[model samples]
Target: MVRLRWYRAAPPPDLPVRQVHGFLFAPDGRAFLRVDGARHGLPGGKRELEDADPAATLRRETWEEVTLEIGAPRYLGYQLVVDGGTHRYAQVRMVALITRIHPVAPDLDNGRTYRRLLVDPRRVGDLLGWGRRGSRQAAAARQRAVVEFALPTLDLPPDGEV
Candidate 1:
């Protein structure tokens, strides 16, 4: 059997940063994102490397925050950021396609709120350009990179179709 391995990276000092985050998109075209109370921003939105394996961290965070089981994920890209002038680190982002996604049962009190929404890739430009309340600048920066690099690289069908 072939051995499978994941890429790893180190974290910067000072800031409370996510080591890695899973960016899961459903066949129906919804993305998974979590609202972090601590940062008052979306948690899984920005990818990063954690003490643990980044892929493992993504799976765990997805289950914990959204209660979704992510299948084997593929490495999509990475994002690096400098925050508070003291903290700097890179976030490894992974992507996985799931068939179905359900809300967390019993709403396990995880101290934060998570909402899964279907987003049109075409509209991503407007969303990021205008920005939302509580959205992190770092996350936005990373997302911009994904939109520029990953999306075009995929060469998927245009909006309202796929």
Candidate 2:
């Protein structure tokens, strides 16, 4: 069985970080989601060797994948993925502000341009279908976004136009 335990703290140093993915919020208080075919997921990926840190990894990945830029990232926590009672590795998560959005282009790494969706943070859990865990992370991202980026609480139009 696979288990994901959310933590508000960083994983132990001994645990190798296999991946880094998280919420990337925009100035308008909407979070970014990458849509590849029908799968909806956050905008992040594996750590590259030249990445100075986790935040660096996020910055580089976002640009490489979608040509978007982000501000300083605030570490939220990680989802320690466990399988069959064996600890695998930590997937670090964070919340950051979108600074700039460049023209859409093929990702340098994969050569595929994903459909980027700037959705309401309130709907992220539903979009990702992560249930309770996703809902909690969405809430945390909203709170951190307001504090870290000085973004207002998520306020969408009644007609749901972002």
**Which candidate number has the best TM-score?**
2
Residue 53, candidate 1: how far off, in angstroms?
Answer: 1.2
Compared with the true structure, the alpha-carbon lDDT of candidate 2 equals 0.83
* Candidate 1 Cα errors over 4 Å, as ranges: 1-18, 33-52, 84-86, 105-109, 128-162
Candidate 2 versus the native: TM-score? 0.91
Q: On residues 1-162, what C-alpha lDDT tens digit does candidate 2 reach at each position?
A: 999988889899899887888698878778788888898888889998998899999998889888889888899999889978876888898998888889888989989879888877778878888889888887887788888888766465321211
lDDT of 1 at 60: 62
Q: Candidate 2, which ten residues in sequence have the lowest lDDT sum? A: 153-162
Looking at model 1, residue 88 earns an lDDT score of 56
For candidate 1, the lDDT comes to: 0.47
Q: In model 2, which runs have C-alpha deviations exceeding 4 angstroms? A: 157-162
For residues 1-162, what per-residue lDDT tens digits would candidate 1 score against the true structure?
222122233343543445565555545444434433322222243333542556776666666666777666665544455566555556665666554466644224345555444354444434434244113433443354355334332444434311
Candidate 1 — which pairs collide?
19-48, 19-49, 19-50, 20-48, 47-91, 48-91, 48-92
